[model samples]
Target: MQANQSRKTGVLLVNLGTPDSPEVPDVRKYLREFLMDERVIDIPFPNRWALVNLIIAPFRAPKSAKVYKELWEERGSPLKFYGEDIEKMLQAHLGDRYFVKLAMRYQNPGIPEGLAAFQKAGLSKIVVVPFFPQYASATTGSVYQKVMDVVSGWQTIPEITFTNTFFDHPKFVEHFATAARKYIAERPYDYFLFSYHGVPERQIRKGDVSGHTCQFGACCETLRADNRLCYRAQCFETTRLLARELGLKEGTYSTAFQSRLGKDPWIQPYTEDMVKKLAAEGKKNVLAFSPAFVADCLETTIEVGEEYKEVFEANGGSHWQLVESLNNSPLYVELLADLIHQRES
Candidate 1:
């Protein structure tokens, strides 16, 4: 059956997905829609389409396919695998009282399909977890929009709750920071780089809670009512707060953005630029942190571990480290459980 109509609580694990195959056509299909989302690229359609198709699709497809090759294990995309693992673990913990499923925003197992799975199961309350620690219009908000679109026609909507952002969640901080600390503990590092996927600066300003607070510096510091989820602001705040928890000194750390597409200005201190400068400044040992993600994916694996490592070493940096994402870490699973407990409470 396509779906069941039950009244049990449902938990949906949603993430930005990868193509089913590494082939250029499959990769292109994924990239076409992923990049074209006005929320993701936020550029004019013609320019965005031309840039993605003529430029990025042609050039990036083959290269990205190679990276995907590295990321593909026996289970396929690590994002999907770990997402499934998280769901299973959570289900094991929660038992038959709740239903848990995974959803990908862009590709297969989409929100609609995932929703249908729940609707088929007859779930009446659903929790949408987008797996991004920071709430961005591009990630978490987009997932919510997609879910709403799918369930709009339903005679009844589930009691939907989303754990929008978990940067400050104690379990979350413990999972990634502890993993990073363990990795860096044995090494002497000159600087720590917290790199998040970049979004256009315009998006931040456009949603600037108040007309005046989206300056990207002062606004994102303390997590005020206005800058709650400002992409740039939230990234910085997550970095700062985490750094404080980890006992990092002021100059010992910096925040930068990676995975930027096209020429439109993105919020920065770009990660690539940071790598060069750190190398130029003679910082021999550097650490890269991708706190935005709870699980490892192409962005964390190939982009930071491989691509940025090459840039740093080639520029004369002696050591570069890409910290692992919190992939099925016991604490991370515990974190998800705690979130479930909180929600159910």
Candidate 2:
């Protein structure tokens, strides 16, 4: 049945979640849920369970907890804080015509609660936007599946539209470019590094509908129908757009992937490796960008901003700058609003 005309449309913004607290238990819980997802681990159930429970969770949680503590803010997680801010800003921009809700794919302010709010409001249509800019099975795919799983339990579900990815969206690119310009205007940099969160090479291969489509190398250098849904390709496309916007010259900018886990080969060159290479090459003044994340979190704030910065400095680099993310920026809000409007129209 169609929704009642009197009810407003609903907008749900979903992001990769964070632990409820920086404590060990909370971090463990979050990691268990996040790593256990089939889309994420991409292994058979028996193997995946053993890997997450018997190995990764037990060993990784405590160390991860420490990192979370380091990344935690006075207001709690910067990721969750930005999600809330974006929700509020989008709601204000959209006014009362729509019900805007934010949810984390894994933790508190979850999909169920967000969906329930829309259900309570008797929304006509629901637009679910995964905060991932690129379509990766581990991120956007998992979010979509979780959203569907939640809605499946409801007796009545609204017409739901999912925005899979917006990697090349002009406004989305503009938001990052604007943020980058603010940094560039303040200082000069010898090189720009676009570092995206890495996924397994197998994951990239899995995304290819045609088996032979993803061969790495020049395969991901350009975006085409064959590799449109390929996360690595989309990431490169994002870097290209931002480079164009910033007027970065050839060889001045490079792309690398970060936050690789376990021993399996993930997309490369790894961000850490890139940092050392830049340092050795005498690219002392470096500007780094993590466009994989729209909001600053442990990965962006600690890993890239702090960890990678240390790596650069230790390897003979004098200056290492991380361009801040588009957290609750007006341009970012506008981009979200525009996405919602486009879906509604």
- Highest-lDDT candidate: 2
Clashing pairs in model 1, backbone N/Cα/C closer than 3 A: 3-120, 4-120, 4-121, 4-122, 5-122, 6-122
Q: What's the number of clashes in each of the models? A: 6, 0
Model 1, span 144-211: residue lDDT tens: 88888788888877788877777888877776677778867798888999999988888878777578
Candidate 2 global TM-score: 0.96
Q: Quote the positional error of residue 121 for candidate 2 in Å.
A: 2.3
Q: After superposition, how far is residue 176 of candidate 2 from its true place, in Å?
A: 1.9
What local lDDT does model 2 show for residue 304?
Answer: 92
Candidate 1 matches the true fold with a TM-score of 0.93
Q: Which candidate should be chosen as best, given TM-score against the real structure?
A: 2
Q: Which regions of candidate 2 fall more than 4 Å away from where they truly are? A: 1-7
